[model samples]
Target: MSQQIPFVDYLVLGENPHLVANECAACGARFFDRRNACAACGATGFRKAQVATAGEVRAFTIVTVAAPGVPVPFVAATIDCEGTSVKANLVKVTPDPEHVKLGMKVRLATHSLGTDSAGTEAIGFGFEPLETAIDGQ
Candidate 1:
């Protein structure tokens, strides 16, 4: 069996997959990457904060152009997970204006992105419509 690993360090894969962010101790600002100082308050302290699994679409664009071998016509969206803004792809839904809209509820989801020569599988995360998540479709 191959070992599965998250494509990003912030993604936690298990029974319940979720993302963790680096929160500024002083200003409550959250970031996905490590920061020596908080951009909001210039605080040097940080803590690990778990991001909400559910969020609403704040903005999105249907990308029809991409690098070679990459799929086109995918929905790239900015999700507001609680108060944190998350940039991810909308999966399991048609990448059309009629199908995707602002304020659409969504939740975290993961999929396998094949494996490497070392037999290690990489898992990538995305957001899907909340209705589909609830209906298990």
Candidate 2:
């Protein structure tokens, strides 16, 4: 049976993207989520801020172990994007995973990890090796 979906968004299409966040007017602060108040100075005014799509891998770990049906040696990294960044898992592209190092530029892309309770998978985006990032081919 087909599952119903609420909304679907496509991120990190061909090039890296801006995860569009908000910046505080009072304090020099930025956040990924939209908020009515400044997290740093409680200012209600904000401006549109875009986070860097491409970033270097700040940190990573080799998962010698994983959950059921998952493969071991998978890599998880904390991407350091411009301004505010987040951690993401590399998918679809592998570039000498063993030699993967911190501060390596990577691109963001959407990956399929099966449906969730909402029956949708594009709820968020993930990072992939820049070598595999789509470039309007």
Best-fitting candidate, measured by TM-score? 1
Error of 1 at 17 (Å): 0.4
Q: Relative to the unseen true structure, what is the C-alpha lDDT of residue 33 in candidate 2, on a scale of 0 to 100?
A: 64
lDDT of 1 by residue, 1-137 (tens): 78999999999999999999999999899999989999999999999999999999999999999999999989999999999999999999999999999999999999999999999999999999999999999
Clashing pairs in 2: none
Model 1 stretches with alpha carbons more than 4 Å out: none
Q: Model 2 residue 104 lDDT? A: 70
Provide the lowest-lDDT 10-residue window in model 2: 4-13
Clashes found in each candidate (C-alpha, N, C closer than 3 A): 0, 0
In model 1, the worst 10-residue window by lDDT is 25-34
- TM-score against native, each model: 0.98, 0.63
Residues 36-89 of candidate 2 have per-residue lDDT tens digits of: 888788889988766777888888876777789887666788888775767667
lDDT of each: 0.97, 0.66
The RMSD (Cα, Å) of candidate 1 is 0.7
